[model samples]
Target: MPTASGSRARGASDEEPLRPAFDGPLARRPAALVARLRQRAVPSHWSSWSGVVSFGCLLVLVVTGLLLALLYDPSGALVRYGGSYSLLRGVEMSRAFASTLHLSFDVSGGLLLRQAHHWAALVLPASLILQLATTFFTGAFRRPRQWSWVLLVGVLGLALVSGWSGYALPDDTLSGTGLRIVQGVTLGLPLVGTGLSWLLFGGELPGTVIPRLYVLHLAAPVLLVLLVVARARSALRHGPVQFPGPGRTEDDVVGFPAWPTAAVRAAGLLVSTVGLLVLMGATLVVSPVWRYGPSSPGHAFAGSQPDWYTAFLDGALRLVPPGWEVVWLGRTWTLAVLVPLAVIGTSSLVLASYPFLESRVTGDRRDHRLLDRPRDVPTRTALGVAGVTVYVVLWAAGSADLVATQFRVSFEGVIWTLRAALLVGPLVAGLVTRQVCATLRAADRDRVDHGVESGRILRSPDGGYEEPRDALGAAQRWTLTRAAAPAARPSPPGSGADARRG
Candidate 1:
C-alpha cells in the first residue's frame, strides 16, 4: 500500500474519476424551446380577456377566409342567358364564384365551411366592438393607449372594407348591385372619380370590378394584420393600459400571471373556434344559396340583401334619391351616391383622429383612473349615438325598394321619407341621448353626495322600502367636469388642529 504504483491506484480510486457516458448531440431542441417558452411566456403582469377573444375571432376569420379563397373566383367574366340565349351575357360565376359554389355543393363539408367563414366574418366585428367598448368603459384608451385606439378604429374600418370585398367576390346579382353602388360612389367623387372607378373595375364599370375588388379584398386584411402587429408593438412601447390607481404600485392591480392565464384564455378561444365551426356547419344547410344564382344581368334580385355587415350600406343606397343627378364638369354625377361616400369617409377620418383631438381640446396628458360613465359624459355619448342612428337610417335606405314594394309606396316617396328621416332622426336621438345622460348624471351626483337608498320598510306611515342607489364605478362616482378637471378638494379649516383631534 505504501508503494508508488499502489499509492497512485489508491489515490485515483479515492479521487472519484470522471465516468464515461453519452453527452451526445445536444439533448433535443424541443425541450430547450419548451424551457424557453416557460421562462419567457409566463410573466407577472400581462393578461387580457378582450384581447384574447379578438385574437381568436381574427384567427377564425383568417382560416375560414383562406378556405373560401380557394373556392372563390376573382374574375369579371360572367354569362347571363337564363333561357333562349347562348347562356353567356350577364354576370357569370367567375373562377372564384364557381369555386365557391363547388365548395358549397361539391365538397363534403363545403357548405359548412362557407357558413364558418360567414360566421367568422360576423364575429370579427363583434369582437372589435366588445374590445373597443371595454376599453372605452375602462378608460384604457386615455393616454398612451390613445394611438392604439386610433389604430383599432382603422382596423375596424379596414375589416369592414375587407368584408365588403368578400361579399362582392361571390358575384351574385345582389353583390353585382352592391358593386354598382360602389362604382357609383367612386365615380361620384369630385375629381378623378371616373379614374378611380375604372381602376377599381380594372377597366370599365361592372366589368373586371369583381376581380379588382377580390384582389383588394384579399389584400386588405393582410395589411390589417400587419397593422395589428404594429399596434401590438405600441402596447409594448407605451405600456399596457392597467387598472386605475393612486400610483403605479403593485398592490392596486388584480391580474393573474401571464402564462397560465394566457393558456386559460387560449382554451376559451379554442372553445369559441369550435363553436364557430359548429355554427358554420349548421348555417351551410340552407343559406342564401339560391339568392346568388349562376349569373344574370336581366333579372334583378327582388330585394337581394348584402351580407349582414353591409346591411347599412344597402340601407344607405335605398334612401338616396332615385333620379337626382348632379351635373359636374360636363358629367352627370349621382349626388345621392356621392353624398353618402363623403359622409362615410369624412366620418371615418374624423373618428379615427378623434382621440387625439379630444386630448388636445381638454389638455389631458395624465393617465385616467376612473371609467367613463356614459351618462356623466352626455354630449359626447349623445353625439356618438346620434351618429350611429344616422348611419342605421341610411343603411335602411338601401332597402328602399323593398320598403316601397312592401308598403305599396312609390320608390320616390320612400326615398324622400328616408331623406327626411336622416335629417331629423339624428337630431332627435342626440337630444334624447344627451337628456338621458344628464338625468343619469344628476342621479349619480345625488347618490354620491348623499347615501344610497337603503333601510327596510319601517312602515313609517309612508309604507315605502327605502332601497337606495349604490356608489358608481370610481370614475362615475366623481362629479363630471366634462370640459374641465374636477374641482380640487377644499382644505379643511385649521388642518393641524383637526389632525390633532383625530
Candidate 2:
C-alpha cells in the first residue's frame, strides 16, 4: 500500500541487508582484524623460544634433505667407483656408496648440503628435547595440553627413526656396521623375528637394506610434517601457557603477539639457525663416506660409534650382561636384547603417559594455563632428574670402550662401574634433587611471607640491633607466592621475627 519511493525508503531502513556476516575476519575491516591479531599475546619466557628453534631446525632439515635426495642413489647393487676422489679410484662399492661419493665430490655444494642436512637432523632432536624438558619442568603438559605432549613424544621418536634410517643410507662401513647391529637385534625377537628381518632386509645382512631405509627416510619426514602441523594446530587451539607472574593468570597469556612480534623473532631465529648450520657444514666434516669406503660384511673397524642421539640405546645394549640367553619352551630367548628393549619401551611409555598419570594420581581435573615452577613440585622435579640421570648414565655407557682406553681403566671395570651407577645414580639424583627443591620452596615461602634482608643494621631505643628489610614489588611477590605448594610454618633464620626473638 506504500508508494515506490516509500517502499525504497522502508527497504533502506531495514538494516542494510546483513552482508553475509562478514565471512570471518577477512571480509570485515581486515586491517583492523590484522591489528587485533598482531596484538595477541604469547609467552615471553626464554623456554617459549624452544618451539621456534625446533620448527626452524625442521625446516632446515627438510630443505637440505630434499636437495640431497635429488642426487643420492639408493640402490645396493655393487658398482666400481670412478669419482674424482683419488683414494677410492677403482673400489667396488654399492651403487648407493658410489653415488654418495659422487654427490660428495662431483656435485657442486653437495657435501655442504649433506653436512647441513646431518647437522639439522642432529639439531632438530636436540631442540625437540629442549622443548620437552621445558614443558615438563614447567608443568605445561596438564589438561588440554596433554595431547600436545604426546605429539611431541611421537615426533621425537620419528626423528630418531629418520636419523638412523638416513645413517644407513650412505652404505659406508660405519653405516653397514649399524645395519648389521640392527639386523641382529631384529632377528633376536621371538616369533616375528624372521618375518621382520626378511621384511626389512629383503634377504640377508646388507641385502636391499639401503632402498628400504631410503623409503623410511623419505616417509618419516612426511609423517613428521603432518605431526608438526597437527601439534601447531593443537597449540593454537589450547593457547600458550605462561609462567606465573604479576597480572598473569590461567585465563590469559602475557607476551608478544604472532603477527609481527613473534613472527619477526621466529624469522630471525630461523635465519640464525640456517646460517649456523651452513657455516658448520662449510668448516666441519660429518659422515665422510669417501673416507670410510664401501661397506663389506667383515669390514667393521674398532671404535666406531653411532650418532650421539642414538648413543643411549647403544649404551643400553652395551650395559647388558653377556650370556643372558635362556631356554624357555625349547626356544632360546635372547634376554640381553629383550631386556633393554623392554626397559626402554617401558620408560618411553611412562614418559609419554606421565601427565595423565600425574593427573590421575593427584585427581586434578582442572585446566592449567599457568606453568609451575620446578621448586613448587618437588616430587615431580625429583622424578624428572632421576629419569635424566638414568639416560646420562646409559649414554656414558655407550662410550665405555673409549672411556676405558682414554682414561687408562679396565674395560670390564668401566662396564661394571657404569652398571652400578646405572642402578644407584638415579636414586641419589632423585633424593638430592628433591631435597634441593624442598629447600628452595621453603626459601620462596620465607621471601613471600617476610621481606628480604636489606643488610642495614638499625638500633632500637633499647640497644638491640636489627637488620632492616625491603618489601618485594608486586611482580616479585606474585611470582614467589603463586605456586601451589603450601607455605612453610616456621620463620627463617635471620628474618626480622627470628632476629627479634633472638
- Best of the candidates, lDDT: 2
Largest TM-score belongs to which candidate? 2
lDDT tens per residue, model 2, 306-340? 99999999999999999899999999999999999
The lDDT of each candidate is: 0.63, 0.85
- The TM-scores, one per candidate, come to 0.75, 0.89
Off by over 4 Å in 2: 1-33, 455-467, 484-502
Rate residue 164 of model 2 by lDDT. 90
* Worst 10-residue lDDT window, candidate 1: 493-502
Model 1 TM-score relative to the real fold: 0.75
Error of 2 at 237 (Å): 0.3
Evaluated at residue 215, the lDDT of candidate 2 is 95
True-structure RMSD, every candidate: 9.7, 7.9
Please provide, for model 1 over 1-502, each residue's C-alpha lDDT reduced to its tens digit, 9 standing for 90 to 100.
4554224553346665674584444654655554433333222222345566667667777877787676565765543333222333344455555665667666777677777766667767777766766665445677767888888887887888888887767666667766766766777776788788778876655577776787788789998898889888987555434432222222222233334454676687677765865576575453454445654445466676666666776676566556778687898777777766677778878777767777888788876533455665676687778877887787787677788899998988888887898999999999998888777767655666674666533444566545554554444333333212333522222211100100
